[model samples]
Each structure stands twice: as structure tokens, then as C-alpha cells.
Target chain A: MKRIFTPAFLLLTAQSFAQDIKPEMADSFRSSGKIYVVVCVAAIVLTGLLVYLITIDRKVSKLERDLKSLDKTSN
Target chain B: MNIKKNWWKAITCVLLFYTVIEGFLGAVPARDILNETIRNLYFHVPMWFGMMTLLFISVIYGIKHLHNGAMRSDLIAREAAHTGVIMGVLGLITGSLWARYTWGTWWTQDTKLNGAAITMLIYFAYFILRGSVEDEQKRARLSAVYSIFAFVMMIVFVMILPRMEDSLHPGNGGNPAFSKYDLDSKMRLVFYPAVLGWVLLGVWIMSVRIRIASISEALLNHSDTHPTS
Candidate 1:
């Protein structure tokens, strides 16, 4: 009887401890569906930056073309 | 830009858009201390990957310059290194922000952190060494040799040393990398593409810098030959 009681008591305590301690996460924020707002903001910023980079790339290509023409005329 | 030639830039745009959206919406393994900030893995880790790729390109150009004695190779090497430094700075800042929320401090004496700092300083010295040389040929020769040496040192500090000792950063010291256990299959779907996208972005910036440098050099030569214009 004593041996059985000791093991049972330990198991009960362990189960309670496991249930009491859980890692914290932003489940509430996610459940509310506001994560889409964050995602959209990030996407917009990235798109804006990429557009600027494309313009710079086009300008460089124009410069290269002009230089090639100048070389042909000079030669 | 030609569609065939510039397809990779379009891919970059698509991959990044996917990353930003999927990264936030995707499910992650629940773990203590990390929580929501575990999402940073998608953004922060990619910066280091991009930096390493740019620096590796720099080393390749350095070797090419030595082999062919081409100033064009030297220009590429310099621009690659510049872009690499920019990526590294971004990596450091993002890592610090992640650490502050997760590690409870803005800075710590972690092995990987210090290794990254030392590597940055070594590259900084490489730049300073280049600036001090007056002769272009001599400067190119000296810096090419130094770039090779610096790349080796970077591999040592950022990769090898961190693994040999105890480090707070994962994948170092005996700690398993995030991929081994923490990064589930769902997270990997975003992570790999994020690495590729960020690395491609670094290459794009480096290429732009190289083009600008070449244009300026050509303009300078044109002015020298025809002062009337």
C-alpha cells in the first residue's frame, strides 16, 4: 500500500506541473487576424524599394548605351 | 532591361514577396523564450547568408584580378566587398534586435557575436589599406592579396571558431542548429527561399555598383582624351 501511494503521488504532481507551465506565444494576436496587417506593410515597403532599384538599373543601361555610341563616333 | 536577362530580378521580387507573406502567416513550432520572435529566423539569418555570398564573390574577383591583371576584376572585387560590408552591418543590427528580445540583453560576450565583430574589423582594415595606397596598380595588387587573406580569416572567425567553443547562438558550440530540430518542415519552406532571395539581392546591388564605377571611369577617360567636351 505504501509503495503504491508514493508512486501515485509523484505522477499526480508531475502531471499538474506539466499542465501549469506552457510556453507563451502570440496566439491572441494571431487569432484576431491582425497578422495580415503586418504582412501587408512589409510587402508594400519591399515593393517600393524594388521599384526604386529597377529605375536605377534602367538609368545605368541608358548610360552604357550612350557611352557605346560615343565610342563609335570617336573611333 | 531584356526579359530574358532580367528574369532573375523578377524572381527575386516574387521570392521576397512570398517570404514576407508566408513568413508571418506560416505556423512555427512552439518553444519557450523564442515565441513569436522565432519568425526573425526568416529575415535575420538570411542577411548573414547574403553577406557570405557577396564576400565569396569578392574573393573570386580578387583571384581573377591576380590571374589576368585586369582592372575590371579589381573593380568588381572592391564593389563586392563594399556590398558585403553593407549586408554584414544589417545582419549585426538585426541580430542585436533579436537578441535583445530573446536573450534579454542588447549585447553579450557570445563566441559567434565576437567572431562576427572581429571579421567586420578585418574587412574594415582591408578598405583602409586600399585607401592609403596612391598607385592604382600597386593598390590593386596589394588589396587582392589582402582580400584572399581576409576571406580565410572570416571563414575561421565566423565559422570554425564559433563551432569549437561554447556559443549562445545556435548551431555553435554543442548546440544543434535550428534545422536539426527547432525548424520544422513548414518553416524550411520559407527559410531556403529567403536565403536565395537575399543573396540574389546582394548580388544585384553589387552589380549596380560595378556598373556605376565603370561608367564614371569611362567618363573620366573621355574627358581626358577630348577636353572640348
Candidate 2:
């Protein structure tokens, strides 16, 4: 299969390079695109925490709804 | 800035923004193995600091629960411990990643690492102990009692035992700590704010959980009084 590299993918690839203050110091990570892997891993960790927080938030919102219904019934 | 409701939260947001931007962009010491990985200090080490602060808050609430027999205190303690455990796990993951990059190993039998694992184990047991009891008051009292004991053990394992050994981590076996080594002024600026940001975030999570728990308990009480409700 001939793979067509879209502009979006190419942009991502370009930005994946190391944000090195010393360009000479980051020979491998910059050239080999390894820094993006670290960025991706960090993003995954943050996403996991965010998902957990969202789940809890939704659960609380649901319970609050249930409580509101119970209040109506009691009234 | 409303100090009671939103000030700290706003500060947390700003600090976190600064941490994410400056943490990556900031200059770090060019050392041998930890050349670039030193930046992990902002993320990994702050997790430990935030976890420690949350756990300390948990123990304080535990003590308060025991003293006043306040169920709210117990709820806060439980939620704080829960959030602290999550933060601690994150710290362990980040530390492991940093270690793998710097030391060529994901895990080591280092005293500090072992202490961290043991401390995590103790807190995990605390949650399990909370789950074992169905009765509310009994659960609260026993959990409070055990939390105090677990915290003391945690202090011994994490603080004392690690110091008694030669650690690859900083500030062990008479080695100078981070401040003495590479915690230069530039790093400190981001590092302190990162710690505060994470700890505030932990507290925010705990507060939200506590609110939900209280509401659920209220609902349960209402149902007990009115069968239809």
C-alpha cells in the first residue's frame, strides 16, 4: 500500500522533535523522534487521571439528580 | 480573589500552567546521565511532595475524627487518603520512567524505592480495611485508629529506613539533598509552584468526593425515613 502522508501527520512529525535548548546536546532524541514518545506517555498519564476525575464527577452529578427526585417525592 | 472559594484554585491553575510551560522550557543542569531527565523532578518529585501533604492531611482528619466522633472528619480522611494514593501511584510511575532513562533500569532494590513501595502498601491496606466493615461508625473508628498506626509505619519506612541506607536518590546516606545538588534557583521557581499545584489539585479532588459522599448519605437517610423517597 502506498502511504500518503497528510499535512496533519507531517506537522505532528515536525513538532515531535526535541525542544532542546542545546541543539547539539539532543542529537539522538531530536533526530530519531524519541522525545514525542515521552510527551505521548506523559499525555496518556494526564488523560488517565482526567478520565478518573470525570467519572467521579459524573457519578456525583447522577447522585445529585437522584436526591433531587427524592426531594420531589417527599414533598 | 475570594480566599475561601476560588483563590487557591486559581493559584493552582496558574501554577500548573507555569509548571507545564517552564518545566519543559526551563534550563537544567547538564549532568552526566541525567542530562535532560532532570526535568522529571518537576513532575515526579512534586507528586511525592503532594502525596505526602495529602497523607498528612488525612492523618490529621483521622485524629480529628477520633477526637470528636465526627463522621465528616472520617469522610474527609478517607477521601484525602484516596486522592493521596492516586498521587503516590503517579509519582511512582514518573519516578520509574525517570529511573529507566537515567539508570538503564525500570526497577531497583534501592532502599528509597523499597520504602516507597512499602508506604504504598500500607495505604492500600488502609483502603482494604475501610472496605471490610459494613457498619458506618465501626468502620470510621477502626479506620481512624489504623490510619494513625499506618502513618507511623509509613514515616518509619519512607523517612527513616531510606536515610539509613545508601540511596541512588538524592539526600540519603549523608548525601546532600536536591537543594545542595541541582535545585538551582531556576528549578526552585518551578518546583515549589508545582508542588503547591499538585497538592491543591489533590485537595480539590478530595473535597468533591467528600461532597458526593455526604449527599449520598443524606439520600440514604431520607430513604430510610420515607420508604417511597
Candidate 3:
């Protein structure tokens, strides 16, 4: 009984929390502080992508090594 | 090879150098009402122009795809659309912030704002439409048609609607744009470079994004043939 009530309470808490914030609140926030938010978000997103691009250079070297190993095994 | 390399690098560097100089000079006093937010105009306007330029390129690719039914054209169209969406979003955000500081409100329901929003929403819908469809060919074909329609609508809404109505936004009918208040040789120096810097930056970002998308596509295709356990 306690387990079932606990799960039900958690679900209700999640739904209630979700209902507390209106979509318009986010829109208002965006309108009010768009420049700062955009700059921050763009910097974060671009940094992540740039880092990913950089890692691909490493992956290419690994692939080259693997291919050389494969040729040696075949020989 | 040296010449070609230098040419691309030169074009990029010249633009960057100019933008840095202009951006620096822009910090100096403006003899107009625009104030500090006016500095954003140099960055913001060029982004909007770049967005328009990219959207036009997207339309060209869309038309070519329709004519040839080639996947490569579809890829180009998709890349251009993606880039346009980014620039458009940036333009809207910067414009809105500038408005809040200058007009004392984040939004005014002004004709230009409404038009810009509509234009962004139209392109946004293209992405949603593309996502909803499953067949690659059908998705490409339908999105191309929609993009062309959207491009036409965007021009009408942004360029025409503002002119037809009374707008607080400058550059509307009878409203003086940058030209009306003489660009002054000083501003022009910074203005041109800002345009080039921003446009080159947009292209650089877009190329990186496109390369990432292509790699993801290749990986997906590779996995499809060699099912992983």
C-alpha cells in the first residue's frame, strides 16, 4: 500500500509542478532577455559542436590505424 | 594552390579586420537618437540581409531539385534552409532586444515585427513538415514546393506589408532607413565590414553544420548495412 501511494504521489507532484508554469512565462522571459540568453545559448551550442568536430580528427586517425591493422592481419 | 588559398583567406580576413575596426569605432558617440542599441544595427541588419540571401539560395536549390530530382540539390536546399533559420532567429532576437531598449517594449505588434515573425514561422513550418514525412523523395519534393511558396510569402509580408501600413520600424514606406540619416563616411567604414564579418561567420558556421550532418548520414548508412549486435 505504501509503495503504491508513493508512486501515485510522485506522479501527482510531477504533473502539478508541470502545470505551475505557463508557456507564456517562457515567452515573456525570452522577450525580456533575449540578447543575453541568445548569446549564452549560442556560445554553449557552438562550443559543443566545435568540440565534436575536433574529436572527429582523432577518430579519423584511429580509423587509419585500424585499417592498417586489418591489412596486416589479411597478409 | 597558394593563390586560391590566400584569396579565400584574404576575403575572410579583410572582412574581419574591417568589422573589428568598425565595431570599435561604433563605441564612439553617435550624433543620432539611436543611442547604444544603435551599435546592434550594424550586426543585426547584416544578419537579416544574410538570412534573406541564404533563403534565396535555398529557393534556388529547391527549384533546381524540382527540375532535376537530384538528392544533392535536396541536401543543398536543406543546408541553406537550416542556415537561414539560424540567421533569422538571431536577427529576430537581436531586433527584439534592440526594440526593448529603444522602444521601451519587447514587442509592439508593429507591422515589421509581425512580418518578420511570420517569415520565421513559415520557414519553421518547413522543418516540421519535413520531419512529418517519411519518404525521402516525397519529403524533398514537398518541402521544395513549400519553400518556394514561403520565400514568396516572406518577401510580401516583410517587404510589402510594412510599406502598406504605418510602421514604427525604419525602412518602411516614407520612414527613413539608414540612408535617410546620412550613413556618414565614418559609419560606412564599420558598416561594410560588419556585413562581411557576419556573413562570413554565418557561412563558416553553416559549412561546419553541413559537414556534421553529412557525417551523421554516413554513419547511419554504415550501421544499416552492418547491423550491430
Candidate 4:
């Protein structure tokens, strides 16, 4: 009985160890709070691109206005 | 820059800013084979959505051109297609990078990936078709017809075909979509807004391209009218 119990106990412990192996994630990075750095960098790049797009949009609007005036003057 | 006129652009900025911040910081289900890369859903999926939306707009403009024979409509269709292709290419590259780490291959013969590549090639051919034609009216008419065909083909390749067969991509084949498992309520908070933001950004870019095209067309006409100037 004692011998049988020992092996059963071993199997239970092995199963518990297996269950402990959870899927790995960036827990350490999050815990360290350095993930904000990445978030900030991405936000900055997106902001820059959006700003550039706005400038292009404004330039196009100006060009259209100028073209309209030019057409009026020529007519 | 007018708040009332460009409210959507403001929404685009706000939604994207929220997505960027929440996407990284948000809690996600830990699953094997995906792990942290699952966060890519917010970024990668939105590209495809944006492409689809832009392409749909392109086809609508193509139809408008066909009906009215308007050069402006043709220009809008062309520029929208151009922007859609850009978004599709970005989607492909980002998907490839994500696959490299998770799927263990940079390129696979998967149905979805191959379908996307084929769709992009078809659009590239659309541009070539336009370039090959020398006459303006002829080019507009021909490309408008071709854009309709191309848009249909895109739908087939990217949408229909992928679902008809087994694909490595989620939501295809026998595999369940991320929404069924990993894309929990938390991710949805970011995912839906990300889709909206990216689609808006694509439209903004397409609008800019269309404006630029209009300016060029106007300049050409002006030069033709006054050759000395």
C-alpha cells in the first residue's frame, strides 16, 4: 500500500508541475512599466505622420484656391 | 483644419491614439503560439479593413465615372485604388512579419496570404492598364471598366476564396476566428476603434491623392489653354 501511494503521489506532483507551465507573455516588460516607452514612441510617430498629412492637405487646399482665382482672372 | 468640416479626421486621431495606448497596455488572453503577438490584431487586422473600405470606395467611383463619363470621378477612382493598394501592401508586410515569429515562416502558401498577393498584383495591373493608354478619354473609360473588374476580382481573391478553402489565417478554414477565443471584450474595446481609425486615415490619404490629381489635371488644362504661360 505504501509503495503504491508513493508512485501516485509522484504522478500528482508531476501533473501539478505541468499545470504550472503557463503560456509566456511580456509580463516582466509590463511590470517594469517600460511598455509605456513603446507606446509613447508609436504615438509620436503617428502624430508626426498625421501632422505631415495635415500640412499636405492645407497645401493642396491653397493650390486649389489659387487655381480657381487664376481661372477667373484668365476668363 | 476646420473642426466642423474635418471632424472625422479628429476622430481618427483620437481613436488611433487610444488604440496605440490601450493595445499595448490592455490585458490579453495568454495563448500558446500567439502570446504577445496576438496584440497585432489591433494593428494588422485594421490594415485589411482599411484596404477593403478604400477599394469599395474606388469601385463606387469607378461606377460613377462609367455613368457620367466624368474625369473627376475617374481620378478619384484611380487615387482610391492607389491608396487601397498601399494599405493592402502594408497588411501583407505586417502579416508576413507576424507570421515569421508565430507561424515559423515568413511566407507560406496559405490561401489568404496568396490571395492577398494576387489581389495586389491585379491592382498593379490596373495602374499599368491606365498607363498603357495614351488618350485621356480612352484611358478614363477603359480604366473605369477595368477598375470594376479588378474590384470584383479583389473580392473573390481576398474574401471568397480564402473562406472556401483551408487557410492559416484565423477566421478561415476550420479554424475559429480570434473573436471566438482570444479577441475578448478587452481587445474589442481597442479593435473596433482601430478599424474605424485606420479606415478614416486611408480615406484621408485617398482624398489627398485625389486633390493632388485634380490639381495636376487643372494645371495641364491651364497649360493647354495658354501655351505661352
Candidate 4 displacement at residue A70 in angstroms: 1.4
Residue range B32-60, candidate 3, lDDT tens digits: 34654555657788888788888898899
lDDT of 3 at B228: 55
**Residues B26-115, candidate 4, lDDT per residue (tens digit)?**
767778999989989999999999999998999899899889998898899889999999999999999999999999999999989999
Shift of residue A53 alpha carbon in model 2, Å:
5.6
CAPRI tier of model 4: medium
Residue by residue across B1-229, what tens digits does model 2's lDDT show? 2367656666666677677767764555556677767778888888888888889999999999999999989999998899989999998888888889877899899989888988999999999999999998999999999999988887888789889988887878766677764548888888888888878878878777788878977877787888763
Give me the TM-scores for chain A across all models, comma-separated.
0.67, 0.59, 0.45, 0.73
lDDT of 3 by residue, A1-75 (tens): 335544544554445457544222122322343434454554566456545644663465455556556446544
List runs of model 1 lying over 4 Å from the truth: A1-21, B181-183
For each candidate, C-alpha RMSD in Å?
8.8, 6.8, 15.9, 8.5
Every candidate's chain B TM-score: 0.97, 0.95, 0.88, 0.97
- Candidate 3 Cα errors over 4 Å, as ranges: A1-75, B1-10, B26-29, B224-229
Q: What is the descending DockQ order?
A: 4, 1, 2, 3
DockQ of each: 0.53, 0.16, 0.02, 0.61
Clashing pairs in 1: none
**Native interface contacts kept by each candidate, as a fraction:** 0.79, 0.21, 0.00, 0.87
Which residues of candidate 2, in runs, are more than 4 Å off?
Answer: A1-24, A27-75, B1-4, B181-183
lDDT, each prediction? 0.88, 0.78, 0.71, 0.88
